[model samples]
Target: MPMNRIQFQPGLSMPEFFEQYGSESRCEAALERARWPEGFRCPCCGTWAHCVLRGANRKMFQCNACRHQTWLIAGTIFQGTKLGLTIWFLAIYLISQAKTGLSALALKRHLGVSYPTAWLIHHKLMHAMAAREERYVLSGQVQVDDAYLGGERGGGKAGRGSENKVPFVAAVSLSDEGHPLRVKLSPVPGFTLKAIAVWASTNLAVGSTVCSDGLACFSAVTEAGCVHQPTVVAGRKPKE
Candidate 1:
């Protein structure tokens, strides 16, 4: 798609074009502005350094105190990036400006780069979303379930209960008003008493009422100290 067709609304924009146009130069400039809002100083000696950029080293700022020149982008995440300032800025713009997230494939097409590069950039960004990654103890009228993530392994009786599966426990907490709050997930090697206890103890807070299936494993784990309210699910029937 053409650059002009990709419209940006400063804060509220679409996903695809957002990734295509975010420029790294813009990002670097902003970084510089934010880092040195008052003025540029020699990072090494902390002096109100030279006015002239000096020589052909565009990235370095000259220091008058010790005459030491250091890279402006040093220690920042952008220091080692190989892409141009414009391209990097455009990539950042595309990712941040978009309301709904852009897929890696869409970003690859827009950025004219390899699939791996686009995927890496997107994943790297997703890693930084800390607020979205918070873990909470789901309490008060909750539903807990076990899910198998990854793949099953081994064969037959040898693998009966030891299928080398990555099992995950999940809990969804509801507010007093019954609005959903948050869910917690944890993966384990086996669905044992020890495993269940660990998962629950870490994710569920003490004294927070819990509702779960009436299983021996859950029984043993619940004794690890939280107050548990059991609901048995047999065949297709659920008995509270």
Candidate 2:
């Protein structure tokens, strides 16, 4: 038997995050290093030699060869932002480093920002995350379950037709021993064959086996080049 070389590491806490990215200048330098590791090259023209101009707020990078000017946060998510770099870093830490994740209202209170600002930041960050997730494919044996999220609307309809039920599919990839490896919870318009096919195409890997309850729409995974195994629940039940 061999030990798994993969190791799980914990995320940075608030104190640790502050120690590393505590000030705006530190955040700016870190972002610059991450974006242009070799050196600052002019976006307009490919030149390495550049000078820094201290503006009212941000520092502009001027290429000596091409005379093109650019800022540290230009062309990035932080572009044309009134918020400070430290605040943006804090928001990223809270949204990503948290174990259970944080809500927009909670982020608003934690960052001391207004509701609209917190909501906007959270929305953009989450949208970016989902866009990134679209590039990944779930491999190996996958267990999939159909589900509906959201609570019932007060004094409104109930059951599947309830106004509050947002249909979704929860799929989890399993290791060789049947342990859950990774999970994907995606919202779909409905549990129809078309929706399931679309979800399978986007999320599941080709030739992977999908296990699910005996649902007709589960067959749609075959259209995505995956094998489907439907399970039947045998029990004594009386229809009321």
Top-scoring candidate (TM-score): 2
**TM-score, cand. 2:** 0.77
lDDT of 1: 0.65
Q: State each model's C-alpha RMSD to the native.
A: 8.3, 5.3
lDDT tens digits, residue span 1-240, model 1: 656532542444545434533554445566678678987887667899565463333356777888877666566545666666555556666777666988889889878989998887677666654335555455566667767665645564333254555567777887898766887776765667888787777677666667777654555446546676677556533432
Candidate 2 clashes between residue pairs 3 or more apart in a chain or in different chains:
none
Error of 1 at 42 (Å): 14
Over all chains combined, what TM-score does candidate 1 have? 0.53
Which regions in candidate 2 have their CA more than 4 angstroms from the true location?
A: 1-9, 98-101, 153-164, 174-182, 231-240
lDDT of 2 at 229: 86
